[model samples]
Target: MLPFENIILIDKKSSIAVYKQIANSIINTVRNGVLKPGTKLPGSREMASILNVHRKTVIASYDELEAQGWITVFPRKYVMVAEKLPLLHPKKWDETELAYSYDNDLKINFRIIDKSWCVERDTVEIIIDDGHPDVRLSPIDELLKTYRSFTSRQPAIKSANKGTAQGTVRLREEMVKFLSITRGLTINTDNILITHGAQMSIYLAAQLLLNTQSTIIVGKPNYTVANETFIQTGTQLIEVSVDEYGINTDQIEQLCKKKKITAVYVIPHHHYPTTVTLSVERRMKLLELSNRYSFVIIEDDYDYDYHYASSPYLPLASANHQGNVIYIGSFSKLLDPSLRIGFMAAPKNFIVQCTALRKMIDVGGDGYMQNALAELIKTGELKRHLNKTKKIYHNRRDFLNDLLQSQLSEYISFTVPNGGMAVWITLRKDYSVKQLQNTPLLKIIRTDEESNSFRLGFASMNEQEIEITIDLLHNLLKKQ
Candidate 1:
């Protein structure tokens, strides 16, 4: 007889009746190919003894299985699986029926967006990511310890069930305090909404703020993913030119005069793709215009914590006297990208609407992980880790700068970023990105066509890898 003891597990406290659970378990075993058709099962008394249930309960389970066509019962004798067992198929057509050809009949109506922005470089051993942090430097052991501590407490696990869509109360409170100390933002828990990451935060902002025919201004060479998010909402994007100082607020002002702008998306601190900080004068002007034109400012400060040189500029949201800035920040760059913890700070009313929308998409973030992060903040572990990694990254930035100046100065020109992780290098006019790709080993680094620049992420590379990369680029450019 088949071992009913191992196959079936009846939870005594579950709302589902024990007999039904047993029946369901057996059916699942059959479906999973664990118990083959025509396999013999133990008698009711034997199964009852094995499962420690009443013989009547076992009989009821078997009877239910028989009623469901899962098994056949012979009078006063044997029970066996039905000869014709139910099988799942993609379609329910008769065996003799002709198969349907969907390719010929169906026509796709949706627009196909080009995803050429994402470069596929798995085959290349050496990678130059677009400004990603070194995962090796993350304090994963401490984080895992905190996670274990959170799970050990029964109360903490139970409290996770009551977490709000906005986020865990503990993490929100911790974030409020953290921001106040670091960024000089005096905000309460009411102004914040935690998201899976900055991308979700951007999507939420776009969904709530933009409607069809709505026009929002952005930098010409902006974060491609955020640009895609805004476009998907049917919003028209007005591109403004970006320089060393950042996106031109004068152009935004000109656009505002022409039409009623809905919102303006900016990366004020170390702007994405081009690591240029928005000038102080432009920041004040943008804030002033936001008040006058009454357009929301979406500021994504993704790598605010990884600033290397001097103190980084304060986010626009921190100085917003007129509550129009929806500030977004993520800890993914500080830690690992796999740890998706990001937050949005805006006016309390905007946060409420965003929270409601967030619920419709995701009920809440990972509560246990949030709580663990809260503990890390409280214990000062997170701050300590940031301090430790900042030094290492700063040294790496210097190393990269020195190597580039010595080896590849003839081929490319770049600015040494004061704060962010990546150095934006503008290729010489003669050496196109296509020409660089002709080199066997130098093709892996992603290049932007808009500015003819390469954003070489150096934080993740070690001394040896950085040396190899720079030497390879130098040799390749010399041949050209």
Candidate 2:
């Protein structure tokens, strides 16, 4: 009565013998708990008629099954599964519901690394992110158009599988020229490795350069994700104090004298949590110390495009360090955070190793998307988009600063950042940032309870939205 015909598919043209194929299919069914122990199988003649195969083939398959201990064939009787075989109870075939329902609170047998620090908060109606770009302002349509064109072209279709682990040739070539003109980087395709995002590039650099015995220096209250990445490497993380002028190079030099420092992680352009640019003096000193102590500098210049006051400082990678700096940058800040496109510029030899390791984790990135982005860069559409967003973001930054100064001066205080999307706000001693975060309606993603501060992002919000957010904050403060 069981659907033996549907379950046992036959391929007459296969190199495998037809009888052996039928035998193997039945064995698999038993292993999968479908054909339970003691279950009755169709007679050889009946199965042959149902399967549209000759009775001799079905007889041979049943004999093979008996020899393999999968079934028992009684003389002048029906065929059935072996009586002594292990029982594998399967769900009833006529049941409508699933056999096993999934439970979110399932128990695990293995231990996992504690990643409590990286918490993904539930999104509310209004979210205040930590310096993210507005996706509405990105030139996504233009990029997608190019992507479609590439997919249709014969040349691109042919090269789809030929992309290198480093990146697509077109994107790398375009990046070489783009970085040279925009960031003043003197490099070729060989010096760059495209990654999923800035965090990925940071991870790749950290994994290759640091080990358990390694000592790396970072700014106190540095980028949380970067700190966590270094900590995961089991490296000794020495935190240097970050002042208005940026991370103290004097302390780094002292540490270098005390021990062999492996690398120094810096966010020179508008450092995270507290947006302070590294001064030209400290930049030079850090380079000098790297040359003196032979420690690598991991420069993360995430938001280098939105300088409102004046021209932003050139990245440390653009300097003359004799290949001591690993520069990381991201287009996510320029476009949208969801668009994960980041690149690393390093010495050719170092890049080769990073590319090899990156392949172990990610074989290759979205080749079509990379090629599309390359077209945008080549046609100056990316630059035009940046110019348009820069003006808008610059205005948003000032607007938020003015609103904070004029309305919320009594509750919070912060220095106006020259560049970057978020303003680092320090709360008064009487109030805690926790109070704002505990509210139901507003969601502030980045907060430091220790510093009694939070990063208020404004670039993603327009003037009206900013006013609405401020009003909500005003009500919360007034309630207190």
Candidate 3:
């Protein structure tokens, strides 16, 4: 007999009964061919003494093994391995099978798509991102307190686990009230669906609306991620030029006349890459075109709350009477991007479809965080934070603009934006982004080739960092 002590080691702390553990160990040994058929096992009394388990425990293990056809028990005499074990099919091993490489058999059919937008910099110290918010301003303590409070309550914990994909009812209700007062929209909780972020909302919208036969009208230098999302849906993208006054609506109307456009994706408030607000005249024209062409208008007002100069334009959804607009917004800009909280506002039927699709992908959003945000909104903490950040961002924006004009006037030309986080600086045609990126002093900033612009985000940086970044850019430009 193989030493029973070496074969079966019982764990007293395990939740599994001692007898079951012994039975499982013996079964595993049998399956592994460590114990051959017809091999005799120790008597229960001797096994119990060797294993340091109760004699009854050893008897129960032997009984279980016999019941499962792993062993046969002779009448009060001995326990032997069964001639044929349960659920075991012994196959002869072929040495030739080991010669084949899995690499050829396990091949990936899909092509890898690169979605990297930011260049990796190892030595760069200052980072000028694409209009990201300062997470230092986040009320982490208050949020944690609210989260702890919710988790401490049994009812809240239970409700969180059973939350709907459309998000918690309380958060939805709070969102309805918040959007109504801030964006001047008359909407209820039924018209809203909370999403992971604006990116997820864009993807869900694209999935519901577009097909291979559909055409999506977008700005020439639009949000790259949104453009990629539409592309992944197998839809044709018709790029219209975006100037100082936003996407050319006249061109969009011309496309509408030629083809049956499915949707028009626009960042009308502050166009990505170029922080130019859509002219009021063009906004009206786009709305009229959407109504006439029967195309869905995807208005991505991502950073709507970060306006500095003047009152921001009301979202297209607020004036959309024909129900052709699906407005997407995110609190990621106001809070932290990692929070991943965004909302989509559309017709109730559309929202219902989005909710169903969202359920298929994700069971629900973070209920605790959503509930905490709702509390912040209800108690005016979110509003106060926004107000405070707005002033700080506005100051930073102005300061960055002054530094750019004073230092980089010879090498770059830019228009000061009315109400966005970053200014769009156009490097002189002679200078290449590649050359700037190679320079050690200017590697921190990201330059876009699609728009011939550099989006220098000022909202996240302090005055000292901003000055240092500007000084570095000035020195780099002077070297050229």
Candidate 4:
């Protein structure tokens, strides 16, 4: 009946038993409306004869169907499709139609918040990124070797899946020593909370500290993402001027005198876009202001590793700020951006709250990678890698500065930064920075048309590649 032999196909090689396959086939046939509710199935012996299978296999299939409530069986009576089956309308198959596919044009019923704040990603082969590290120089092999070591061991496997929201114990322990030696930060494991990246750390701090009634202070042309994150919290973001000496701390002091400042977000070392380090005097002033005003200080020291000039300034968090500073740093700059490992150091109580908040969004981080980094630090591989890359980046920065000065000095002017991997170039009044943006061969990562300036990152490119980029700019300027 209904070509039972043709419909109930089976493979002896399949992992699923033939009986279960037959039962599933019969259930599908019923669901597909080929067999109506209350329709009688052929007897087990008859089905075995029709399907050319053993009688016991057919009996077992019938028993399974009966147990699953797909069919009703009676002693010395026929097996039938369940009479009280839920109604399921059969979908007509169409050869020309493709539905339930990965389509972006979704007809959503609910309202979504405006995503105008989100930056759009352009698919480009070669882009002048905003001071990214050269991934070619990353210690991938050593990291992978450590990763393999972890995967091969049972204890490591258990530790990885242990799922601690604060991050792996080995990494936190190593980070305490690492920060102490590198940044002069006197922090312990409890004060640290590992995050996906510095952006996550920044966002978490904003969410915890700022609200509608809160007011946060940032530099005028601060890190765009941090500015956006602060704004999204419905906090009043007061922007002060950032001159050659970094954010005007005096202006910040004036603002603090006028109203209560909730938090101050500062990039003291190599300020974003401008590449100006905050004066040591201003650094002391800001700390004093934070203490006086009773405001939190979110110190974002991303890319603190690649400072080319003399010894880099120690972070505000490094100095005694009386538990008022939340220091955020990232390994994304240290290694590769996609690796996405960062950490936040604050007071133990603040870190506990951050870890709790982190769990609500993400249960845990990549324990394997964290442990691998810990091992690297322990073996001095991370430090060696950093030392080697720092030299290369410093050379590249100087080379690019020379090229810009020698080749395009007529069109643009820039301050050769002491420590960072980028040059803060101010374009001439005659030419718009927009011209550089439109060049097909080159993509300027950032441009301020109002200020007639753009930041050119050099660390990601070699001397030869930097030469090519400069030549391209020279040719474009000549055309303009």
Candidate 5:
């Protein structure tokens, strides 16, 4: 049985004040022991419907009841009977009630907005989840074999901070070999600083490179987490518009001449939210601008490992001649989020200061995880596992795209991302994002764009789950 099953909704539209009438009914119920402690009162919608008035009016009455200690309202979605509050209560209505209503000039209540259908957590969603990179896809057997080999050796375990901040010699050496052969990035261990995640590396760069006086430039509709971090650090955020070719290098040149822009952040391989890759020509132009402007380029190498269509772009850091580009990379994305291990390749001059900043922020990453991850890469388990996981995620992405194209394309425009776990979607102009947002069960952030752009998380959902979510979204959009 549900709580607060008793109290009948009483609606009386009269000259008497609505709040008073509602309050009077509740007081009477409590006085007669019809309402008990720890009982949840109906939501504003439920009460307003029963009383045939606006939900706000019922809320005002509840507010009055709560102020007088007759009841309580929680920040969470619940109103309840207060604990042991003594109130003057009458079993039945008195003549004074009519006289009080006449004096107060109360009239009617407003109808309630139906809000019971949506789950609140869906309001904001995380971009990366624990399920991606399908750890199962990784050669767990191979990793365990390496782990057993490591444990079985019983070699002296080094402290996390023993080697250069770029990471231990063994790991950095492995990465140098991996990037040199794969991405054509010729980086040595001295040029790289190992970090917890690429974001943490980004945050550390912000701390070391930016302060209250610095102005950081980012693309419009940027990654939410990076934006939040910038705001917290009090750095001025400059939003540059992006074209189909990726970030408009022309706009960036203009901004550098005008504003005191310190750092530029870009997702060159697969741009966040929007899957447009920075074309090779634009990357060269961006690198040139960074040199000309005397500012550092922050290349977020996010999802560089999961290229499905086009070849991955050579990173901005790979072209750093002026020592101004800070190239960031991470395995947490394809390997595991919990691994909390990534590397930043910066100019040799900035490594010490960046290390100081990194030490102050997290000191050192986990030795065990680092060693295990290094072993995974050293033994080729990392690349082997990533391929398997990417294939699975690619299938899920295809399924979602097919559903949207078949059923939702008439209402929404979307492109399959060449890489990454998220798909960028633009809703039809016929439907306003604000309307969809206010609709019941619509779980999205103030949304990525003022126009209707929503990111669908396919990494965590199975094909069936993705189908259900798409159907629900279709119904919701159709209603609007």
Candidate 6:
């Protein structure tokens, strides 16, 4: 049976603005596998009495959620969970929208793509990218020929009528092999449940572990997409301060003592936007903390593939002796973003719960993509492609670094990752970054707290385009 989860009461000592804290607590309960997805929550009056807060406060918190699409409210006293929604890969930019936008100069393309919604604009625009990995590096021609040549196209996926919940077996087998080599993780077809992308993987993890009112902590100014994923799943995100080693572990123990934190989300391996790697010492400490606090650690291993540095550190999941790490990753950053194709590495004990949550939300991932990716992995096409593209992205990273130093050195600075697709460029001065947002050259979509740093997707662009864009951006920075 699930543990006791109760009405959230905000204390005077809570640092989160009371409304945000309350709403997030509710979300945490729903997402962290606590409050079952469709369970009805207590009425505002009832909740207020339980929490010792004014009815108006509860109503106000519920109102914030209603506006943001978290819950549905009936005229009087009825509140129910909205349906569980699945996040597909980050493929929101539609060509129809792109064709009509009429911004000819500001053309962006998916060198990589998936569910990142915090673009500076609400409407997802096809971000013109310079750093997409060379798809030519992949045997696209051979794969297409093989795809067409398949004489008997046996219905790509078979377990359809049964609610394609466990993902295609062929795909799971391939994914298992990939994890064993890449992350030093091992699990057979039964352990790995495929999802559209890492976004869904993380969401599914939250769905499995948390309930409304459970505390879920993440890095401060975390990747907006993951933040949104947790928030949408009804998990309240507690932002923790991070440093070179990783999240402030001391605060984690403090927060857990103060509140029943159900999960802790971290990008210990080359974190998003900041590009900081968690020291191995810290990875073990975090595992220890999780064991003590009874919380789960979400390890987002997004860029483990394109390691520019020698002997890149192993994943937090690798070091998770307590078996509490929920490891998530995507193929998008390594090779192709459009392919989506990500999975989770959790303890055997937790897989059933996660799969049950996934089954409720998305019966199974797309059959065609899963089958094709399975074939790609089985035939060694994906691995060969990754090896070939790594050199190119490494070169692109070098080129972009050179261009930044040569042209924009005095004005701006960026973190050079040992290996990753994009550079997390934080301006030495904050105002310059803010001013750049006003340019037509700059396209902002759904941008929130990530106003201080801009991600330059270096792996998507060719060197020439990279050089020219950097030149153009250098002049813009000078003007700013």
- Measured on C-alpha atoms, candidate 5 has an lDDT of 0.73
Error of 4 at 470 (Å): 0.7
TM-score, per-candidate, Cα-based: 0.78, 0.80, 0.78, 0.78, 0.69, 0.69
List runs of model 6 lying over 4 Å from the truth. 1-136, 149-151, 155-163, 444-451
> 1-480 in candidate 6: lDDT tens per residue?
222124465667967777677788877666544566566777888777667778898899889877766678886868766566233236556633232234345566644344545344533323434234556565666555655544245553243223346677777778888888887875677677677778888877876666667768988757777776677656677888877677788888888888888888898877776667887777777888888877888889877887877878878777636777788887766556676678777776677777887877777776655666678888888788888888878888898898888888777666677777777666665446557656766553322234466767777778887877787777777776
List candidate 3 stretches off by more than 4 Å: 1-106, 116-123, 439-446
Name the regions of candidate 5 deviating beyond 4 angstroms. Answer: 1-132, 135-153, 159-161, 164-166, 432-446
- lDDT scores in order: 0.86, 0.90, 0.87, 0.88, 0.73, 0.70
Would you list the clashing residue pairs of candidate 5? 53-109, 54-109, 54-110, 54-111
Model with the higher TM-score, candidate 3 or 4: 4
lDDT of 1 by residue, 106-127 (tens): 4768677767766565555456
**TM-score of model 1 (CA atoms):** 0.78
| Deviation of model 6 at 257, angstroms | 3.6
Task: Give me the runs in candidate 4 sitting further than 4 Å from their true place.
Answer: 1-125
Number of clashes in every candidate structure? Answer: 0, 0, 0, 2, 4, 44
Among the numbered candidates, top lDDT falls to 2
Kindly list the per-residue Cα lDDT of model 4 for residues 335-376, writing each as its tens digit: 998998999999999999999999999999999989999999
- Model 6 quality (TM-score): 0.69
RMSD of every candidate to native, in Å, equals 8.3, 8.2, 9.9, 9.7, 14.7, 19.5
Task: Show the lowest summed lDDT stretch of 10 residues, model 1.
Answer: 97-106
Q: What root-mean-square deviation over C-alphas does model 2 reach? A: 8.2
Better of 2 and 5 by lDDT: 2
Ranking by lDDT: 2, 4, 3, 1, 5, 6
